[model samples]
Target: MDTKFDFGEPESQNTVYIRRVATSTLPEEIREQVPDLDSMYAVHDAEGEQLALVRDRSMAFVLARQNELSPVSVH
Candidate 1:
């Protein structure tokens, strides 16, 4: 038997990705929340897990920063 341990940075590490998503492509339930916008920005973590959806790119970045995470553009 061998005993080996590895301690490295977490997979997520508070990093987030920001990208644009068309409102029309979202589900009807989600679409109802942003009736005034045709498109919005989506924030996701390093694991590609969505965190929040905002009406604009700036808001997406702000939201991530507010949560103490680094934001990056997906495209």
Candidate 2:
């Protein structure tokens, strides 16, 4: 069975998304700074603008809350 819930748009005004980013996808300038890590976490606003890139998922959430923004996992 399939069910659909029209919950409408999320609170984009104050919501941000968290997702994992492959180090390889980053520019060479950034990759050189973290040669020991394979991946990183990114925090982005609801409109898809990247706000920050951190070393871990938890840090991303913390940064968002510290700035009074709601954090949500994107994937």
Model 1, backbone clash pairs (residues 3+ apart or across chains), number: 0
Clashes of each: 0, 0
lDDT of 1: 0.89
The lDDT per prediction is 0.89, 0.94
Q: Write the per-residue lDDT of candidate 2 for residues 40-64, one digit (tens) a residue.
A: 9999987798999999999999999
RMSD vs true structure, all candidates = 4.8, 5.2
Clashing pairs in 1: none
Estimated TM-score per prediction? 0.79, 0.84
Residue 2 in candidate 1, Cα distance off native in Å: 28
Residues 1-75, candidate 1, lDDT per residue (tens digit)?
588878788746888899999999999998988799899999987778888988899999888889888899988
TM-score of 1: 0.79
lDDT of 2: 0.94
Off by over 4 Å in 2: 1-10
The candidate that achieves the highest TM-score relative to the unseen native structure = 2
